[model samples]
Target: MTFYFHFLSRMTLALISVGLLEACNPKSDTPQQPSGKEKTTKTEMLESGAAILQSDSPLQPMNIYLDGFHAAKDNPAHQMEAHHFCRQVNEDFAQCVLFDGNTRQANLIGIEYIISETLFETLPEEEKQYWHPHNYEILSGQLIAPGIPGIAEKELMKDKMNSYGKTWHVWNSAPFGKTGDKIPLGEAVLEWSFNQDGEALPGLVEKRDQRLGVSTNEKRNDRAELKDLAKPQSGVDALKGKFSMPAHPLPGVVDKKAAGPK
Candidate 1:
């Protein structure tokens, strides 16, 4: 998800595509014999074939599950749900691979890399433009790690409130297959967020809050003080705005494009 990852070789790209295809299709210990046929687990598939390719890559054994939205780069108004599988490679950084919501045969959608605020500060100004703050993602409850306890999630969010993320969405698969293809297709887009009250996705957040049994509005009250800790990059405000930010003042531009056009 780095801004400069466009330099990857065709060979490396081929390996990533194949390795991810093999690894992302997770399997269960429960028998998969509806018709008495045996289906291999994602782990097994990787070991048998993708292991070599996966070995060449940094991410291994993706362990965490998170759900968040990706704002279409050309149109920040279009927020798309991204199912994530994350691997924290080191103490300072974690990279997440995003998939379609369909856990069954979920397609590779995109990726995001998160880094601590300290690390973000060390980056040069040009590089900083690629990162966005986690303050709203946390306080607004837009970022969630599913299948975990609420208390644990709160603690986790506390730790990540000041982190910065660099994201790129490569696949444009529609939630309802409304775009017509099941294949991963399209150019990569830089994502944005609904950091303000009126900018939120109505049905999207409503259903997510219902499923998680939590209120995003209430999280705002809970993390009222956390607002003082974040420092979003300059370009982040260009898409999400910077009205009540803790970060230094920066340029701002609201994305005018929409998913289905305004």
Candidate 2:
């Protein structure tokens, strides 16, 4: 009987110790979902890069959205917003981390690497399939930095106009209507750009403008003179443009005015 009582007391002591541990650590019992006000683990991981960024850091992170359809034939246009922290990895090459749209708590969704046209032209035809021109993105105002002045934006685009971008999106959030994504789940997709009006959703751009407090239409109008700028490799297909892309689900494609990718 005495031994039984001792075992019961030890079990009670163990339970009490666990309770004390719980008391010491409020989050020990429950997992934490990142709140809007807090920087998520993913955001921290991505932003931690800023610490290592060169003091001259060619480009600070700029928030922008790209409107396009997924690689699937039936997929409709979705506005893909990303915060690009562009840093020069070398003299003529730069790399960027594409984080989710959330300014406060973003997750790393993809990556973009930019190279000068001089360097791009050196790439063999087959090798070019992985890259896309930035002119279409720049002139159309689809690639925008919100709240910046007109001249500042123009200069920014001008610098990027001839560069080439290679992007791969790992987080597929279009099914959620571009709302939210917690984890980087599912297959990685080769992302494309909306080269023109017919290919993009009208409302998505407006929603992005309102949410971001910038005007895509105004930016588009300001860039009218830039429309004639020659983007030679802005081809109809990713291969023609020399954009390297994955085989499955087609490639990061541009649509011809004819039937639309359906």
Q: Residue-wise lDDT of candidate 2 within 1-262, one digit each (tens)?
A: 2232233335435545667523321121111133346668988887787667645543332222232222221232434555565555554676777665433344566787778777988999787777766666676676774433457557656656666777787775433244545456677666655444445444655655665566676777787677565345433344322222222211222323322543
Off by over 4 Å in 2: 1-79, 174-181, 237-262
TM-score of 2: 0.60
Q: How many angstroms is residue 151 displaced in model 1 relative to the true structure, after the best TM-score fit? A: 2.2
Q: Name the top lDDT candidate.
A: 1
lDDT, candidate 2, at 106: 49
Q: How do the predictions measure up, each by TM-score?
A: 0.64, 0.60
Alpha-carbon lDDT, every model: 0.58, 0.52
